[model samples]
Target chain A: MIVAKDVSLTYQDGTQALKDVNLRIKAGEIIYITGPSGSGKTSLLKLILGMEYPTEGHLRVMGQSMVKDEEDNIRKLRRKIGPVFQEFKLIRGRTAFENIVLGMRFLDFTPKEIIENSYMALERVGLKHKRDSLVDKLSWGESQRVAIARAIARKPSLILADEPTGNLDLDNALNIMDILTSLRDENTTVIITTHATHLIEDKEEGTFIRIQEGRLKMERRGVEAYE
Target chain B: MNKRAYNLAYFLKESKTLFKIDFLSNIFSIISIGLILFILSLVLLGWRVSSYVIQIVEREGEINVYYDLSLQEKDINYLMEDIEKIEGVSSTSLVSQDEAYNRMAEILGKEAGILELFDENPFTPFIEVKIHIEEVDSILDELESMLGIDYIRDNKNIIDRLQNILIILKVLGVLALVAIGVSTLIVVSHIIRQGIYNNRDQINTLELLGAPDIFIGFPFILEGVFLTLLGGVIAFILLKLVLGLGYSKFFTALPFLPLPAEESLLIPIGIFILLLSGLLGIIGSLFGLAKDNEKA
Candidate 1:
């Protein structure tokens, strides 16, 4: 649920990250943005996350503008986003369950719901056995699963996974991809950016967007492809 | 608000974790805050005791009126009635020469042997007029105009000195209160800032998760309040002990000083310190949070 029109982002040092990008993404659509390193994939994600404002043109995520003055509204918009960061950003000194539950603590969820959803997400990520383990003590793969569980526990309408398959074995990366893809439903859209294009080369559905040198090329599948 | 209520335990636990992040520093902060509050409590106690003494002295306002030595008993009786009827006078009574000599002997205590040098009772009988301190000038003027009154000896100098001491005590009390408030605020705010710095990673993660500022900052605020409250309790206990020990020694050493009962002074000062600690804790934490937010 994002819309961008002629959006261009240039950093303070005048390095242009994106140039005149225009795209429209509908709800409940899974998007795989495939690009090489420093190919504006993360920059696009940053724009969508409201971490940076566009230098030119307008961008909207979940009906809220990505502008400097609309920071409060953007924050509200972020509440509906489940972001799996590249580094997994799991808080140290906390158990996996605690980390997951913390994501939903400030949302509109009862204590019981938060705990239940946390457990359910942990089960989906195959981390239920490690739920009591401290995040810092967990292995890299285990910590990534916990981070995914934390993102999914909030039942966010939009999920953005940045480089989820980075540095993972094929089996673990496939499992992670399966968990992220299965989360998409009639009401939830998942957008994933990855440098590893081999993970989803033969997907029969969803949208595939390719970016290179601050430009975009989109390819759709299923009934949208026929249209 | 309801979500915050549900997560109350989480916030408190987070606060505990934050406090323990720098355990030694936090402990030191509590001790310093406690000692500062103890100093404030002592100043307040001094102010209270001094004010009590001044009040007792003011309420015992008196003037000694010496009459004509040749006045007969009936004339003296008439003069007493006239003095009692004065607008500001509470009561009047005659002190005989023997009673005056006895009073001096009691005042001199162990040095009463010097009075043996006198061949007769050297003291003169006078009318002791008790009047309201506020009406001193008017009462003295009235007495000076009366006939058969040879001299009026008022304890105005002592009363003035007592009032001056009370004024000084009040000024010192106010100064101490302001200084303590500022110092507590600074210490608490610095502690909160340090905690925020230590937990900056968690804070950043929460911020990216769309958590409200209140949710993210609540733990730091709780840590601040808990530390200050603990400090306040420590100060209260120390103050109670000091008061207990000081009261016993003061009554033994300077029993003539008018001191309020221990509870009368301790209860109110204890309550005030606790309240001030709580108030300063919240304000200082908020200030720290605001400044941190500005930096962010």
Candidate 2:
């Protein structure tokens, strides 16, 4: 669902976050981007989310060009992609149910569908018992799950999770990974970035990407391919 | 583009939460707006009353025309016909010396004993000419040129002063209206901006979730509208009470002034203020949203 050709990103402070990154991602594929801290893993997700534009090359997400002038189109594209921000970005003074359903309110879901899907997403993340709890009262792991529920509840075509496993114990982080991978189906593509490389070191399927010093290498497992 | 319909209850609930965030400040804003609008309503009431008084006075405009005592009854009849034919004159009728004396006694009320000191009636018979207020000067010129007319006495000074008062009241009313409009706009807009500032985090989250700008800003718009509408209702109540008391007092102490019926005046002005409040609420919210978006 994403195509990047010789993409490069430079910040206003002259920091080159990414250099000549080239990659192709198909629908329904589970991809994991593993790198150390400050290795441009989050920067790649930012480009995919249209939070930043490519400075030197072309990039397209879900058939919409990621460019400054295509703001409206990029906004529409965002509605089709569920993003789990590194910070979670859960709104305070709201219940977990409210936060989840708010993501689908402006989408094509009816009121009934919004409630049902919100509850279902909460159930999937194992937070149904805490659905009524305010996000501010929730623990760090609980907040992260609520953020993930908010993303998957919309049934987006693509899911991009930026550092979803940060500040979590091994069990909680693995549980988050399981929930994210389970969301991938015949029509959904899931791409997750994590600095904790051990989480996906034993994976048998899906695409594995490694980035170091602003350059990236790709390896595929199921297709027996390396790029 | 698949458009989704939002729940009205959801919007209202959101607005309620936003309002309660700073409940005391919002209550103060309502009181301030209501008091401002109340002042405007009082100005409008004064304008309406003074205009009505001017209208009644203009309609009753009359001048006294004195003629030579040597004229016979036929000559007086001819003079009356000629005065009625003038362009500005509405009608003419001769008042006898006895009738004038009786009018003066009625006006003097408890002081009519002053007229009994004279042996003969000192009042002279005259033709009372009713003319249009706007045509007073022309009519006076015509009356001065009439052959049998000895002198003409018109209340031009009183009429001119009344007209000047009407003009001043009109200008003051317009200035008060403009002041009310500008102050209300500024207050509502500032309140909306404050609401937006307080909810900036929620707004940013909504934006990242792909919510449309309209969806993100709808609750804030509702908040602004609700505050202004409350202000309007409070102003309406105060205006009604003041009008009731003012009308009763005027009827008791200044019965000569012509005032419109209470229901007719209050209903229209009440409706107008409420509608204006609603309109300003929407415009002010839009202005706040536009400024916030610019900053973003």
Candidate 3:
């Protein structure tokens, strides 16, 4: 769950990334955030991830305050979050399975659970067969899938994907979207940011928000979308 | 892993990876740390030896008082009885000139060859007094006032000199320990920082994945400890060999020198260095990790 009230973010160089943003996100809902390049999409994700703080206004994610001083607690709260970056931040020289397992190693999972969840996540991302391939050697799409697997392996309640479909062909991008959107199952909230507006036009369910400069331009709720 | 639990095997594997990442550089750090620690060991050995000599001097509580050679044998016997009558004197014995020369030869050991330069015995007879160390001041006071006294050789003077040497050795040992501590800390921390930079991406990824600082930093800590521990072992072995060689030579050159047994001296110092090395490694790694955190 996320709550933002009149949030504004200005960088050190005085670049206004977000302005007076207010939104409420519920658990177990799939959210599609569409925005153009440099439209503050990643900045919002960074705030939720505690990598940045809002210059004004208040924000909370999963009952943890998203402030500068609460960084340590925010980090603990992040354990319940699964984030997929635009660039898959998988460690080089490690196999896809190793990357997935590494992400779950520090979570509250037993050794057996770690192993089982990793294999299951890989299966879900349709990369179970590529589990042995080193991350550096994997193709872009396969690497992205491994990143998604790593994120989902720990069964976090919230999943935030920043441009998962970037720089990919239509087929691969759609495949990634399918995997990420499907990750929003029971008891999981999935928020994805992307510039690929054309792809979201086909989605029949889930909540959608469009960001134009630093402000939200529109909000659309399809069937079965949250209140 | 459970929320508060950690996998030791995983941490060790990560440590191995970190250590292997810059194996050549780590080897150099270990060698430098070892040599520094070896210097400290030598200073510590000097401290121990000087302290032991002082202890032996205090325990023997013995001094030699020379009498006028012009006095007749009857007068020397009366002087001995007078020394015995002193309140603090435990006992006294007359050491003959020949006996004094022979004792010097035995004390010199291999260096006794120097005494052969003399055609005649270059030694004097003296009254050896065994007094309680606590009663030494009163006894020396009494002997200095006695008649026919030529020169009184107080062992307390030697004890004072030995004490000075002990103080000097102690100061040197402390300085050496501080130097080794500071250098090892700097080297280990710098190396750990390099490791962090090399794996910054992975560290960032781990941080984002909600890994606790301990989980992220434990491998680095292990890496530092491994380097210093290796250094400590090297220092211990090299010190052992050097002490072995030095002890044999010292006994040959100055057989009367009081030294603690080799094992008693080495085992404690060996344990101390190894423990200190491990402790320094841990502190250094923590410092490195904390600095990185500040940067982030």
Candidate 4:
């Protein structure tokens, strides 16, 4: 779960990345953040990921305040959240299976759970056959799937995907969106940021928040959210 | 900690990958560290041998007493008896003319031909007195006060010089110890840092993936320890070979030298170097990780 109260973020170079953002995302909900290039969708994700701190106002992820001084606790908080980076961030020189398990090795899982989850995550993303393939040798689409598998394998409470459908063709983007949305389960919250608004336009169950310049406006389809 | 064991195979594989990434550089580092440790071992060997020799020499403190040969045999006997009666003197003996000549020839060995230029035996009868080294001064004073003793050749000057050499060797050993420690630490840590830099992307990925620093840095620690341990083994092997050669071939020429038994010397120093290298390996890796992670 994430809570943001009048949160604002301004970079050192005078770029207002977010301004007076107010929203509440609860556990077990699916949410979408859509905007144009440089529209602060990723910035909000970064804030939720604790990669950046708000210049003013308060923001908490999973009941923990996202502050620079709480770095160690922030790291512990990260363990509960799965993040699929825009660039994939799959480590090179490792197989797809290795990449998936790398995300779970430091968690509380046993050795058996680690292997099982890695196998199931790869199967879920339709990359089980390519598990042994090196990430560097994989195509861009395959790499993106590996990154998604890595994120989902951890079985995190919150899944934050930053432009998971970026650079993919229409079918692949739809596939990624399906795979990401299907990850939501009991006690899990899924938050996705993408500029491809068409992928979620027909989906009417989740809340939609639109951001422009530096402010966010939320439109709930059926779910009730925020204080 | 259980997680660490769970990832033990991965840690080893990652360390191997890191070493292979900079294979030639690591080999050079091992060789350089080995040579540094070898030099330190030599200084230690010199210190040990000198200390042992000085101890043995001190235990057998002796001085030569020369008197006028014109005295009758009975008077020489009296001189010997009087020397034995001195407070600190343990025992005394008179060296006859022929025995004194033979002793000189034995000492000179190959150089004894130089003494043949004399028409007859150039050596004269003298008293060989052995005393406790701590009582050397008192015994020498008593011998000097006795009559008909023309000269006393106490080994005080030689013993003092040997002690000075021992002190110098000890200083050199301590310096070598410090130098080996500092240089090995610097090289190992620098290499670990370099490996960290090379694998920064992997580290960053792991960090962002919620992996702990211990999880991320454990492979690097293993890599450093492995390399330095290898270096320690190499240093020990080279030292053993050198000492083996010393005892079997080189040192045979000077059989009277008081070098320590090879096993006694090698076993302890070998254990020390291996343990120190392993310990430094762990510390250096930690330093490298702390320094780089601080920047991040």
TM-score of decoy 3: 0.93
- Return the candidate ranking by DockQ, descending: 3, 1, 4, 2
Q: Model 4, stretches more than 4 Å misplaced?
A: A225-227, B1-3, B67-81, B93-126
What lDDT is obtained when candidate 1 is compared to the true structure?
0.90
**lDDT value, residue A180 of candidate 2:** 93
lDDT of 1 by residue, B189-237 (tens): 9999999998898898888889989999888899989988888999999
Best by DockQ: 3
Q: What Cα-based lDDT does every candidate model obtain? A: 0.90, 0.87, 0.89, 0.88
| Interface root-mean-square deviation, each candidate | 2.6, 4.3, 2.9, 2.5
- The TM-score obtained for chain B by all candidates, in the order given, is 0.85, 0.81, 0.91, 0.87
TM-score of chain A of 2: 0.97
lDDT (10s digit) by residue, model 4, range A1-227: 78999999999999999999998887888899999999999999999988899999999998899989988888888899899999998988999999998899899899899999999999988999999999999988889999999998899999999999899999988999999888764567899998998999999678899999989988877544342
Give the TM-score of chain A in candidate 1: 0.98
- The alpha-carbon deviation from the true structure for residue B47 of candidate 3, after best TM-score superposition, in angstroms, is 0.9
* TM-score leaderboard ranking: 3, 1, 4, 2
The collision pairs in model 4 are: none
Give a tens-digit lDDT track for model 2, residues A113-195: 88899999999999999999999999999999999999999999999999999999999999999999887753689999998
Q: Scoring only the second chain, what is candidate 3's TM-score?
A: 0.91
Candidate 4 lDDT (Cα, 0 to 1): 0.88
